[model samples]
Target: MRSVDADLIRQPASVLAAAISEGEVSSLEVTKAHLARITEVDERVHAFLQVTGEAALAAAELVDEKRRAGAKLGALAGVPIAVKDVLTMRGVPTTCGSKILEGWRPPYDSTVVARLRAADMVILGKTNMDEFAMGSSTEHSAYGPTHNPWDLTRIPGGSGGGSAASLAAFEAPLAIGTDTGGSIRQPAAVTGTVGVKPTYGGVSRYGLVALASSLDQAGPCARSVLDAALLHSVIAGHDPRDSTSINAPVPDVVGAANRGDVRGLRIGLVKELSGAGYQAGVLQRFNEAVELLQGLGAEVVEVSCPNFDYALGAYYLILPAEASSNLARFDGMRYGLRAGDDGSNSVEQVMSLSREAGFGAEVKRRIMLGTYALSSGYYDAYYGQAQKVRTLITRDFNAAFDKADVLISPTAPTTAFKIGEKVDDPLAMYLNDIATIPVNLAGNCAMSLPVGLAPADGLPVGLQIMAPPMADDRLYLVGSALESALTDKWGHLLIEEVPSL
Candidate 1:
């Protein structure tokens, strides 16, 4: 057998899938190459919480056997992909980076996992995440933070940091992520990968562990726009099990990616998202992306979504209240961690003690804030009022969409910050998602793709493209255009600039 080239791991998933389907390489060889790559750099990246090498190899073998037997295969067959830890995979330890569920192995696969299996994608094990998907940086994880591959001292943007970092570090070609606020996009922004939050119900939520139920939506993460669209095509569509799932056809995402044309498309620039608080380097790259889009024949105009100003405030209150309700099931009597059960304490005492011991500071803080907001005395003032603001934000999106086919902004306020910089200050940490929160509130689709590296710090920067609800195709249309233009200017993908480990 020929030796697996080291550069094989660096190839995009689209290229790998084609190679596997055309008999250019065996599935096991591809899987082993990625596993070897993981071994080489994962210590510094810390992208995965667990590595399912045995299972991955076994799955890859099945794909090879199917090809030998002349059976038809899915588009992504034999591709190795990382799963966010928050999504359940039957019999796999599905820790959402919280000690409360540390050793728990769910008995069922999430809708997303089941889809991946059906598509014949090899599972590369679960990646790290913020505890209960609360923090903007992976530092809130109980296990420890995932370091950015670009700069070891900085954070890989959170909640889905592990997923994005895996792509940036070349540990995996494709990964899964959930966006409740900016978990998916923010991480992709900082890590210089591609992440998309499909229209709220365009993808099923049956298997994603709920963060803020209304805001949570699972999407694809990859190194390129086309790769993300391919994965998105496979995992999307209506599922009868999830009541909130939209009973509609999935968009032609792959087609849009292949189209990659922005001609005659009216792209809106969100006024409220780009001004003060944004870093200088971030703004510079963002302005360049706008010019690139305009050069591609995209008509750019400034549009205001004034209610976006309250999106952050409303998101905090709403997320906590829903999280408080969803997490109420983790009492000591359940399958997760149980503490103070010496038979000397009451059931309630054990439950309280278990929760106190299991949750991290950020989780505990949110739970408390949620509990308080939902209390009878404050319900009308806090939670109710926040819901009203949510309606206004949605209205703002509706109005903005009337004038533009898509909206663009810098995916985040700044490049990846040092790991410990904002961990201590909750308010500072919450501000990281400010630019991403409104899309969630409005139940729209959005994506973040690398624009260029920040000139000052030499870190990757991302540009966000948001589309109207169910018009997810528009995101791909613009994302692929800019991705191609930017790649031409840089002479290579931004990820190629990652320092050697």
Candidate 2:
């Protein structure tokens, strides 16, 4: 058996699928390669909360047996995929990186997990995440922080940081991640991986532990756009179990990836995102990306999304409010960690004590803020007004599409920062997603791709591409085109081009 390098694990899923279909490698072999890589590198990266070695090997054996029997296989047959802990996987402890759900096993799989299983993917393991998917860095995980693979001291972007970091660290070829405010894309941006947050409702949320019901969305994180698209196709579709799941037909994302032509495409550059908030190196890389897009014949146009300025404030208000309500189910009686108090204590007392011991400070703070936001006197002033602002943000996206086929921005203000840099200031950490929050507020589709390395830190920076609701295919088209052009220019993928640490 040949050893797999970091670059091999970073290959597009299509290439791996072809290799598997041709009997070049057994499913078990591929799974073992990834698992071995995880064992070798993950201790330093901290990408996974749990590594499902036993189950993954068994599943891979099934795939290999089926291949030997000449049975048909799904497009992703034999691929290893890491799942974020926020999504429920039956029989596995689905701890959303919170101490509260430390040992709780879900009774059923999330819709996305079911789809991956049906696609014959090997479930590598559940990756770490921020508690309830709330923070910009995975440092908020009750378990521990997932370190950036590029520089061990730096942080991987969150709350999907572990998934992104796993790919960057070559622990898994593909991963599933949830995004409320940039959870998928921001992490991908920093890790130099590809991550997509599809249009809200495009993918079913059934069995996913809700943080902010309206904003939370599950999508793919991978080393390339095509790999992300391949996973996206398997996981997206209407599901009756989730009322909010869009009934719209899922498009051929893989086909879009193959098309990779951005000629005559009208790309919108949001003026609001290009200014003071962004790091200067990020801005320079972004401009270079724009030039590359133009070189590929894309028509770059400035588009104003005025309401975007208020998106962060509105997002904090709405997410906390909804999260407060969704998280109320964690009271001691139902499930998860219970305080050691005796049964003689009142139910309210037990619940309070359990939450105090279970939740981290950030989670508690958000819960309290949410409780207050929904309180009588503040309802209209906070939650009510935030909803209205959400409407306005949605309108801004709708109007932008009138002038452009897609919108673009720097995925994050800067590249990966030191792990503890923003941990002390919650507000500063939240601000990291400023470039990504409006997409969730407006229910649009967005993707982040590595554009180039930031000069100051020589770390990778990502360019974000977004499309209006249901136009997810356009993002693939643009992102694939940009990725192709940029890689050709740089002589390797962005992550590959990084200087060895």
Least accurate 10 contiguous residues by lDDT in model 2: 1-10
Q: Top TM-score: which candidate number?
A: 1
lDDT of 2 by residue, 1-501 (tens): 244645456566777887887898777878888888888888899999989999999999999889889999999899899999999999999999999999999999999999999999999999999999989899999999999988989989999999999988878889999999999999999999999999999999998899999999999998988888999999999999999999989877889987998999999999888789799999999999999899999999999989899999999999999999999999978789889579698888889999999999899999999999999999999999999999998898889999999999999998999988889798899889999999999889999999988999988899999998888999899999999998788887887764342
Predicted structure 2, TM vs. truth = 0.98
TM-scores, one per candidate: 0.99, 0.98
lDDT of each: 0.94, 0.91
TM-score of 1: 0.99
List ranges where model 2 is wrong by over 4 Å. Answer: 1-10, 498-501
Q: What would the per-residue lDDT of candidate 1 be over residues 315-422, giving only the tens digit for each residue? A: 999999999999988896858999999989999999999999999999989999999999999999999999999999999888998999999999999999999999
